[model samples]
Target: MNVKTEVKQIGLYINGKYVPSSSHRTFEVKNPATQGVIALVSEATEEDVNQACLAAREAFENGPWRTMSVAERCEKLRRMAEIILERKEEIAGLDAIDVGKPYHSTVQHEVPRAAHNIHFFADFVQMQGGETYPMEENFVNYTRYEPVGVAALITPWNVPFMLTTWKLGPCLAAGNTAVIKPAEMTPLSVSLLGEIAKEAGIPDGVVNVVHGLGSVVGTALTEHPAVDLVSFTGSTATGKRIMKNGADTLKKVSFELGGKAANIIFEDADLDKAIPGSIHAAFMNSGQVCLAGSRILVQRSIFAEFLERFTKAAMELKVGDPQNIDTKMGPLVSEQHYQKVTSYLEIAKEEKAKLICGGKRPELPEYLQKGYYLEPTVYVQENPKSRICQEEIFGPVVTLIPFDTEEEAIQIANDTEYGLNGVVWTENLQRAHRMSHSVRAGTIWVNCWFVRDLRAPFGGFKKSGVGREGGHHSLEFFTEAKNICIALK
Candidate 1:
């Protein structure tokens, strides 16, 4: 818990330089692993957001970025990826301390994945080409893709580095200038992105980072008329607000929103694989992931035994300081989020749900006593229609439900308004395919979980989100298509 880390003051990256907020106000960035303030970051006001938007618009309209050849744009992104990889350790440490993510997960998965995201888009930009078709004997038709001008990328807190590049990579690869507003809760790692872009030799105003609370800066960024597109990753409720605000300009909006995925484990499943995969789906990132399979649906025959094994695994999860490489679960992102999760525990109790394991905060190491920690909570829902069964807790809490038939399992899984991610654990390949098809979700995992290919389209089906992002899907979203018709003489 006493791991040494470098601390420095943080500021907004406007145009091509790091600067203070116009209002000169700042907020503390705390280490959730120890509840210590590690740095102070400038809090952008409405004015600051406007300035960033103006800069993005200017860059898109008048700067070399938009006019740059596709190969040139891709080269810059590739260079940024190299810079990001060079600072992998530092960024991983920052993510671990900034968002209370386990050190190993950050170091092994998030940081490297972010760098790969940049490079992936770079490759996409290089490989993708325009289309040409012969319409009639005397006419020719062709289609070309162009950048969507200024794009606003509003990313969330849980996985800052990964999500930052999720939006940034495609935005840059498509030759669009951008203004990024990282969630105020976890801003350290993304605040450094501007520096990396500058080092990568990206033209000025191509990428900008503004920091502030969502209510102030987020609203301003989405509502700005000059912004041609808004790509936001956050809660469903907030995504709705962004949609409404962006309606004035009819700006193109892309959202990757909330998810309450149902992890169904059938009686025919390989318990060894199913058990750990389901538990991991629910508990990864301390259950803070939007794709966390928080709802567990078990075949009635194996309900009791599965619950017992799942409870034991949940209890054994190492809950403590994120700085400890051995820790399996770290603290929640903030005191507010901790309270929200705990409040749901009380709600489960009131609704007469069974608390099989972990309903209270774990005793932390002496140095981390003040950290916002919570035990991995498992609940058995008596009523399938209960709020605890339907709502997104966004913490290390999962609800178990028993299903008698495959039809019932599919019904329960698709009952929620969210259709983000789902899992079906079964040895029977036919059943796996059926359940995966039956469940209405964007991503389906069969006998596995969280396995991503980066090339496939990723997005939610219903209230979860709008549009897809991954590989060429992302590149397409960041760009606009124009068809040209020519007559041959």
Candidate 2:
């Protein structure tokens, strides 16, 4: 455990307490930023997962959380949000250590937003809707939003704390109990969330955590008969599998999965505005974000110039220790992922894409040892259909492809199977609006890139996976509808 002060060990959380998993098996969480092991986490088995699920089910069926009124529940969530705000630094520090998230960004961007998200959902739920019926039946009719009991939340390692809040907030707000299965790689920060919830007076077993591999804990949670809903964030392939297993009981399932987003930059775009935003979109979090604007679509007129600007901007990004506030980027999560990314470099080379900047691992920086690191890379390709153009590298890499017309830009943007998000960069308000409608992605960003507001619904259209997270639209993910009828005579 004697490594960087930035990496630390983590324990599992269950029934309002932190403890090791019954199954002593463990996994290492690698910091993508440093490509180093940040924490060693306990791996939960099927039995352990069942224990967590049963705890959540019991809480939902008979515990204080389920018994609480909407107003009471909202109060609890607000209290939890307050507790999070009070302990923001400690939790933010945990995120930087456990996941190698940039501390400055984690503090200013992720942590506050997470706390606000819980509060926002709490406020949103206070206005829970039930429609008054104009029924012709022998009974009066209405509909109330009811929580899907025993929610199984399987969150990814990338944005562990924030995604945990996203899954936890509306779930509790909707009166459901949750068994959260944090990815083995990034389990501790979420465990800390469990701690904060406990301190904020979440009743025992209201929220439980079992840290482990997806195949073990994740499958168990999805397949458990007692679990009523499964919310997952990961690959599209894994989301499909979760849906299949949850279908055994026909449980309600929501997925926020993979993305190969297209970021369209037109000739009319203000390159001054678009270049910086595009660089951030393509390279933020080292481009590991599911909605990272990975595919850069530029009009033929501006393609060369945009490439130059984008390449310079990407190179300008400083990748180092995420704990450093001045560091703009970091390593990929692990050597495995870094290798996967490097392989993509080979593929890009075979496809005849020009490497405008980095495509290989950087020599050891003076400040770090024992972490996987890759230099930021930019690829310029003549063919939009190149393999590098379509595949998701999920690294600090950018592909610059040229498009001839607005129609072709839309076509290229919509060409991918993954459509989580896309950006249309044009000063012309009309063109921005047009392609926003035309793109097949779940979220369409016009002019601005990666400015993800909490109110906007986020998800993908085709292969980006099913269901939406965030926005007023998120309530549907945690709720099921029921109609009550009575005669209006």
Candidate 3:
């Protein structure tokens, strides 16, 4: 559980090389666990964004990366994955401090998952191929997939290490060069990827990392002329802004945006599993996850029993130092975000929802007093349209709603503008099928939560997101399709 207390400084990486910010300005990156300065990362200004874009463009247009054979690209990606695995502990430490994720979760899931994602894409792209069609006896038609050129990837702070690979894995696999802008609050772990790329022999300018506020560097990256596509993972509001900015260039924009997912438990379900499942879904990463099941819809038949068990499990969550392997939960990403989440608790009170457990911060030890912490919060509301039910709190908060029937549960689940993820807990095969078909979400976990297949399509519906990213879906997004026809006598 020991961590470094000394402050360090990090730099931006452009053209496969580390360089200071163009403006020579620096920003402080903090450990959300203790509110202590973790490192001073270069603050990438608009000019730095432009420089990174230029480097990416050069790499995509005339660099060896784009010209390399598919096998060669896969090999490089495997090397990078190996490097990531070898440094998993080191990376997990940074992730634990930077994002306030539990050390156990970071080391067990986030760190290893990132390395696996890269390897998945490396082999995934190799197995993927364009199709050839038989047109006529005298003619042949075929399809080719080409890189989308420069990609602008903007990752959020909550899952910086995982989401970076989520975008970069297939991006580089499909032969696109990129400039990533890690969230200002957590840039340390992502900035380290530049070194991993260099170690893997990923060519210069193939991958770039710029660290700064989203408004400055994010805007520049989205609007840059050389950028062909912009892939963003953050709030829905910011996703809308990126779409507007990239529209001028007619660039393709893919988003994995916000979600207020619903976890529906049927009366026939196993409460033993559903209780912990519901709690874990809502409180994972202190509820900073976009796909967090913030809404729990219970069948009216078992609503009382479910709420009692669910609240008990939520209240038992240990919220303290993320560095502790036994810690079940950690603080919010920052003081500002902590306020945003706590403000919603007041709204819940005003709306007259029953505050079952956790509307206040937990008492911490002396050394952790400065950390931004919030206890697991559960609210029971009869009205599905309540603000607490409708909005994305993006914290450890969940609103429990009761639904009369399967149809009502489906209606309540799909009632939101966001449809990123939905969960259904039912033992009946018929009910599971009906709920899965009826609830509108990119991912629906039946009898389980947060279980994922690397090859499955991952994204959202409605305003949750614009496109999917996983397996071949990601390769398609990062590349464009071209058709070629040949005529013979």
Candidate 4:
């Protein structure tokens, strides 16, 4: 497929206007697939971030959004979802180019999921209600949830559009205005939200976006006094920093952080499903996903067979231009990230792990040669405590460790500091139940990977994150509950 390499200028969307940064500075956003400058985005300074927070604060304090009826608010959310679906192709294209995600996956999966998030939350909020208590005949008590006010939403580069909507949906549904700082590496697709919000009849200053490096822009937003809540999705290290930054003001903070999830395959597992599912679990989005099951634990009985099939499948993944429909994997998001991921190859060698399939960059066409592409890598390690097994490489890398029994599998899986996500592949119902309960993670998948329901609580247990945000959990985080009692005559 022929892809356009048009260069556009993206500005900070503050209040209701698309304006340049206060410093009049801009940064280049390059396409990871072509190494070409796709856009020049505004570099938000502290002043720019403050303006966005002030805009959100002003809108939340005085605008009609907070006072709008639940039905009316939902209508606007539905309209935003509609616009997202209508421009799905355009938005998907931007993300594919900006984040180096496969266009097929973005257009067919992530974009639609982004729209679904808005729709689901809009519908969910309408059915949501508070508790009513009747104490005796003399008095009655009831609770109500109110918008918290200005929210600072910090999103990551991988799956930027979908994750932004994931946070934005509940924030807006609860009637809170927001200032968003999309990952500077992949800011193009999220830059469309400002226009989407306006066209959907959302009031000005209700949803503002500022783009810049996280150190400057993210810290400013988190530390802003006017901001009521901070919802962030990124590295665990950054999540910790945001916590400290917001500590002075005691801002309500929710984070969905990093993971090194364990995908365990029991001997009773169905390899037909496990092989492909495990491949997707490990290498989806070039393994840039926070939920990527980078550790695969196979029962020793089927270890050799699983290794053969898994390595073969990993080698067959198509790595090239993200615009190509057949391309299953694309380049890492940036040169810096490419370097970070490739460093793990050296780490694997230093750890004395067996190199199973891939650990080098693939030979691409002349145009894509300059892109940040790497082959999907797999390794077999005897020691589960190796650095390659413990740390999050955040790339297309997986470490396979052999285990003897379910007890050992559980032990190895829980050994990591991260408890974000895990996968259990087995047909035995009893074992599945046992493993599900034994694994120390937020969400455990049984014979499935990446399948989600909007109603379930989504967050990590340990170092993965601080709080949960999905369904009622999301509403709980975005709103403040108050109780009012009345005395009967």
Report lDDT (CA) for all predictions. Answer: 0.90, 0.80, 0.90, 0.94
Clashing pairs in 1: none
lDDT of 2: 0.80
Report the C-alpha lDDT of model 3 over 93-187, residue by residue, as the tens digit: 88888898988789888978999889999999998878988766888889999999999989999999988998999999999998998999988
What lDDT tens digits, residue by residue, belong to model 1 across residues 355-401? 88888879876888898888899999957788888999999999999
Q: How do the residues 1-489 of candidate 4 rate in per-residue lDDT, one tens digit apiece?
A: 455788989999988889999899999999998889999999999989988989998899889999999999999999999999999999999999999889988899999999999999999999998899998878999999999999999999998999999999999999999999999999998999999999999999999999998889998899999998999999999999999999999999999999999999999999999999999999899999999989999999999999999999999999998988899999998899999999989988999999988899898999998899889999999899999899999999999999998999999999999999999999999999999999999999999999999899999989999899999999999999999999988
Model 2 misplaced stretches (Cα beyond 4 Å): 1-9, 30-38, 136-138
Full candidate order by TM-score, most accurate first: 4, 3, 1, 2
RMSD for each of the candidates:
1.3, 2.2, 1.0, 0.8
- Clash count of each predicted structure: 0, 10, 0, 0
True lDDT of residue 39, candidate 3: 89
- lDDT score, residue 216, model 2? 71
Task: Tell me how far the alpha carbon of residue 256 in candidate 1 is from the true structure, in angstroms, after superposition.
Answer: 0.8
Q: Positional deviation of 300 in candidate 1, in angstroms?
A: 0.9
Q: TM-scores for all candidates?
A: 0.98, 0.95, 0.98, 0.99
Number of the top-ranking candidate, with lDDT as the measure: 4
Runs in model 1 deviating more than 4 A are: 1-7
